[model samples]
Target chain A: MFENLLTWLDSPQTLQAIVVTGSLLLFGIGFYGLLAYTRIIKILISLSIMESALFVFFLGLASDPHKTAPILGDLFKNFEKMNDPVPQAAILTAIVISLATMSLGISFAIEYYKRTGKNDIAQMDALGEKR
Target chain B: MTGFITLFTLLSMSVVALFSLRQSNLTQSVVLFSGVGLGSVVLFFIFNAPDVALTEAVIGSGITAVVLLIGIRHMHKEPEIEEVMMENRRGIRRIAIALLVLLTLLLLGKTLLGALSVETSNAGQALLEHAMQAGAANAVTSVVTYFRGFDTLGEVAVLFLAATGVGLLLTVEKGEDAIYIEPNFILRIGSGFLFPLILLFGLYIIVHGHLSPGGGFQGGVVIAAAFLLLFLTRRRFGLSHKIVTILESGAGMAYVLLGLTGLWLMGLFLGNFLPHPAEKIGMLVSGGIIPIIYILIGIKVGSEISYVVEKLIKRSHDV
Candidate 1:
């Protein structure tokens, strides 16, 4: 049974499964940290981790063993040489978008700390109104 | 090669992720996240995306970690003894989202999966076949600048929008002195050397992006990093607001002028000004208006990011 399971996990079909499983596990842990950690930064970090996992799931599937990088040097000038570049372009935009978001998130964390002198979310629950 | 690496990496990331999840400390979590980032970077390389890999290295590891650590400094970390108080838990919201997402994924998963398999080999091949005629040796840059010039226009607009949103959300009602961080000796000396080097390289990247993998957005980030270094090392880096504002306005104006000018010059909007002779690739002057547009966009994006960061830090302090 163990041998069969190991073989199954090692199969090409299981590659994406492994990635998906890893991503979900990362999400779960981040969520757990978000729940378990009171540090405001930790929570945000967890959120970032969750976001990275999703990016992984998307890009991991696009990679094929047969294809080379989209970059063409002297050796791989032909059409048969490269993998997809669309996802690469898409992810570049996504990475930039995420940076803007994380920075904004940090700025808010700083302001919240200044105002309340507290960073723990539980300590931060002062109704919907700002004092 | 890519497929094998991708699979092996996916497996390795899972093992590392599991180890991290077990650690239960905020710092360990960050390390785990870094592992995840490293894996994603590998996936990017496997998928043949140098640009994305560069971004993931910077944003995913460096910036995200810094931001997270900053957040952690302010927020309380749950001690081992404290009752885990899940405040105003969004269990219902989570369930609703999960259900909605599941339903959507179930319906669209096949189609979405199918879309990935549906190769754009024809389109990519077409671009590759006539890459010389398109005026850029880098096919990705060619598609971005020439084949889809209008889309490139909107992408620049989106960067503007993101900068604007960061501005709106993070700014204070009135300006104040920037955080009076006296530059440390190492950073002070380092910035002196590093800032000029960064600017020089950024220009090189944007100028040569037609033949290389770098382009406006990537080079823009490089330029922004130089400004960021200044913003860090000098409390009174003393950017002349007037100059920055002028630079911003000029870049925006130039993009517009180029577009309108193209109507007369090439009879199409944003057309490459110098006509590339068919099948002539890799000439510095071959890509014509494309390299020019990308350089302009790089300047625009760099200035905007610098302004946004400066404004955010400046507004946070008391006048």
Candidate 2:
């Protein structure tokens, strides 16, 4: 039973479990920060962390022990042994899109900072009932 | 060994993330954020996605750090003051958060385990099988440029929108009493010497993308990094908005036209319209319109990102 547990600990499935759980934990950390932090920049930073966690999870989901990089390099002769290109491709798009979103968010945050010297969400009441 | 490395990287990533949040200093938080980006790049590399690794390394750590730092510098150095206390989360809220976390972990574990039991998706398998026909050695490149070209087009549009939005935000009013600092002598001299070489390397990555693990976006970001280096070192150096817009929009137009050309020649948009000799698989000139689109992507991304960086930097120097 100890040997079985050790083998399981060393297995790729165990690695996958670690990655998934760790990434989800990272996401949870970001969510907690989102709830706790009032600074707009901190909130944006938390958002970026959440995005990174999601990326990690997607990459982890696509990982396989038997497969290699999806490149037809000399070392990887067989196409069948290649890793899934879809997730990598999708991730490339996601990374770029997320960068865009983050930059836009940062810009909005800075703009808000500029208009009112407050970066705290709790303190911001820009759209009040008064005109 | 790979498992151990993955575990270590993720562990460090989590630690850094926790520290980044715990710190009240905005600059330190931004620096730790770069650590998170570095960890992700390592994670991508370990996961056998070299192309994504390169992109993440270049954009995530390189450009993203600089952009975030610029934003931080634009504002005062005051650490954020938090009114909410952890002590405020009494019995009910703490229990709710704990339950939510447990449910999330359970759901994630079940879903990932189920996914692991299945084979790769059919579309992914199909792309891998037909990758050779695209005359590309990198299956990711083929998937990105040819198989899902429309998605790439949309990504470019999104980037365009981001640039526009950043421009609008940064240009709201003239930066009042903004001051610019001149870079040190060593940085100026080093950047001057390394500028051309970095530019050359970026181009090599863009052109060799079809044959290797890089493509347009990664290469373009490298080029933008080079420009950013120049911007940092030289106070007088300024990106001409006219030229940048022309190059950026021109690359976008070229990408669309190339896709339209493929559609005109072949039945589908972004099809392999150029002749693909079997022997040209790993050559620089191989991959038909894939390399072409990649070059365009590299140029467009490079121009737009650099323009964004320039706008952010110039806003700091505005009188």
Candidate 3:
């Protein structure tokens, strides 16, 4: 039974399923944190978590069993054997852009914290009260 | 084996994320977030993208944590750990949110699973076949700096604007009498020793970008990390804002100018206008205009991030 289970786990299809499920689990946890947390920074962190979860999902989605990196390095030269570079490139751009967004969000959070001495989203209902 | 490793990594990262969220202390949260970055670095490697791995390691793990710590330090007070009343912990709200999140996750997972079998697009296949014509060993670099050079240009601008926004938000008159925590003797000495090595490594990464797994962004962030280390240990060491600004803009202009030159010569913006031996692959000088553009990117990104780090560290004291 243990040997059978090991064989089941070894399949590429099973691995892809595990990765996809794991990424979704991460996304769920991040969403839960976003809902549960009131602090502005905590929400930002949760947002970052969600971003990472999507990244994992994207990279995992493009993963293939026999293919290698797209680089034309010493041992690898054939284009046929190369993994898809499009997703990798897109992910590269995504990572940096997300960093920019994260920094900007943090800056706004810091400014907000300074002005109101409060980081909790629930308490920040100035607009609601005015309405 | 790769699958097992990835499973372990993803599991650990999720645990770290959860733990970080649970922590009330700001510094602890930053540290745990860095742990998540480190785990993602492993994942990037497992995915066979070393460039992304390097960027994730340097920018995601190193400089981000340092900047956050600096921000935390400047805030003066400890982060508020709000007490929750039993009545405020609405069970209905919790259940609703959980159910919503589960549904979303299920949808995303199913869609992604469906996407797994899709074949590579014709454009992607063409890019794979003809990537060598650009004379870049790393196809990702070619895609980033050559095919999507315009996007990279825009990304750099975004980074520059972010630094500007951070400076605008955090601006305060330089605190002449700012308290400097005198670092321990070991830390000071170790940082001093490690600083040059880190800088050298960063430069090596930038220069060998075409031949290897790292490029401008990774190298620049690593360089910034080195500067951050120095800033932490030696509080008196000042970064001139004017110099950093000049470097940032100078490199940005150089990148644009290179692109324009490509357009002028080759009749295409950011085209391989510069003379390079396309047949000779893996050589440092092989990739036409790619190496130069990456170097420019390295300088721009390095200065911009370092400037941001310095601003966060210096101005956080005022607020």
Candidate 4:
């Protein structure tokens, strides 16, 4: 049973599952931090963790076991059709949007730091109370 | 086969997750973050989106890391990390986000459930069959141009919006610049070689867009990346700002003008007014307006991205 499990783990299908599993783990940590963590910056990091995990999960779902890069040439010549390019297009769009998000997130971090000199959500709340 | 892997994967993933979750420090969490990015990059490849995988590899791993590192460095100085022990966690917010996501997924799934196969898809089969007539070798390119040029035009609008918004927000705020701008020998050397290489590749991607997988957006981003290399190297590369602005506006203006000109010449807006003679698919002059549109998109995207980054950096003087 142990040997079977190890062998299975080595397979691409298993590898993909493992990837999603890691992503889920990330999502959990991020979700917990986003909710329970008291620091604003830490929460942001947690959110990022969650974001990356979801990214992995989505990408993993897009992969096919016997597929190759959707490029044209010798490999593609033998194939009936290339794998769906829609996911690639969609993910490419997502990547760009994520950059914008990060840029905006960091900007907010800077602003938050400037205003509070503290990056904690709890501390931020105290300041909010002060105001 | 898939079931066993899925089960095992879930098990292994939980172990990794537990490790990350049990970790006491914020720094460890961030380090673990990259692991997730790498895992996803692999998944993207599996999904047959090498283009997406490449983008994820570059931006998700590269630029995202840079942003996070900067954020973390600043965050370390603050005592806020230890101060939070709130009674109420944002469970409500989480539920709301989840519900919204579920709704979106359900809607999307429903929409796709009844979708036609590629063979029966009107746009897909038409482009595949009549691609030669459209002057585009690639069916995708044919669809993008003759069928969906309007969407490409809208994408240009979005790029312009990003540039404009960032430009307006920054307004060339004064601050110490050179001290803030990170520089390195490798960045200089690699950038020097890489920019032109990337630019060359972008042109190839755009020019040959009709024949292959790449298109205006991908090629345009590459061109912007080339410009980014200059920004990293030259610090004050004095990027002929006016020329870039002109190019950006000109490309967009030209697209509209091209469309309007078609209306004048062919008595229809965006009409194939000057459609190049569709002699042979995949040839230089083939794909009539596809190549021209791509070229315009490359210019527009390159300029807009550069403009956005420049605006965000605030053009502060070195202290």
Docking class for model 1 is acceptable
What is the C-alpha lDDT profile of model 1 across A1-131, one tens digit per residue? 86675665445445555555556555655565565555555667667767777787666666554566665456744445565555556666677767667767776776676566766666665566542
Query: Which segments of candidate 4 are over 4 A away from where they belong?
Result: A1-30, A38-80, A115-118, A125-131, B1-35, B70-76, B83-85, B90-146, B177-195, B233-235, B259-279, B314-319
Model 3: lDDT of residue B169: 86
Interface RMSD of each: 5.3, 2.8, 3.1, 6.8
lDDT of 2 by residue, B1-319 (tens): 6667777888899899889987878889989988998999999998889999998998787777777777777666353454443455445446656976896678657755755453334548877887778888899998889999998999999999998888888774454423367777887788899999999999999999998889899898899889888877776677777888799999999888888888898978987889876577877788788888999999999898888777777753232
TM-score of the B chain in each candidate versus the native B chain: 0.76, 0.89, 0.89, 0.71
Q: Per-prediction DockQ scores?
A: 0.31, 0.53, 0.45, 0.27
* Stretches of model 1 off by over 4 angstroms after superposition: A1-40, A76-80, A118-131, B1-4, B11-35, B67-84, B87-132, B168-186, B263-268, B312-319
Whole-model lDDT, model 3:
0.76
**Minimal lDDT window, size 10, model 3 chain A:** A122-131
For model 4, how does the per-residue alpha-carbon lDDT over B155-265 read when each residue is reduced to its tens digit? 667657656655554443354332245667776778788877988987787777766666666677667667666765775564566798799999999988877876798
For candidate 3, the per-residue lDDT at B38 reads 89
lDDT of 4 by residue, A9-106 (tens): 55654454455445555566566656666665556656666776676666555555455544444343322354443344445655666666665666
Worst 10 residues of 2 chain B by lDDT: B77-86
Show what share of the native A-B interface contacts model 2 retains: 0.49
Per residue, candidate 1 scores C-alpha lDDT tens digits across B1-319 of 3345656776676566546545556677767767877877777765566767777876677555654654454344354334334545556437644654564455345433543243333335555565556666666677677766677677777767766665565555544535446877887898899998999987888888777778777777778778777877776664566776687678878887888788788898887777776445566776777888888878877777776666555654222
Worst 10 residues of 4 chain A by lDDT: A71-80
lDDT of 3 by residue, A31-67 (tens): 7677677766667778878888888888776756457
CAPRI category for model 2: medium
Q: How well is candidate 2 docked (DockQ)?
A: 0.53
Candidate 3 on B1-319: residue-level lDDT in tens? 6777778898999899989888877678889988888888898888877777777777677766665665565555543556222345467448956786677567547644665543333446678887878888898888889988998899889888998898788765766324367899999999999999999999999998888888898888889889888777887786876788788889998899889988998898998986766568888788888999999999998888787777666664332
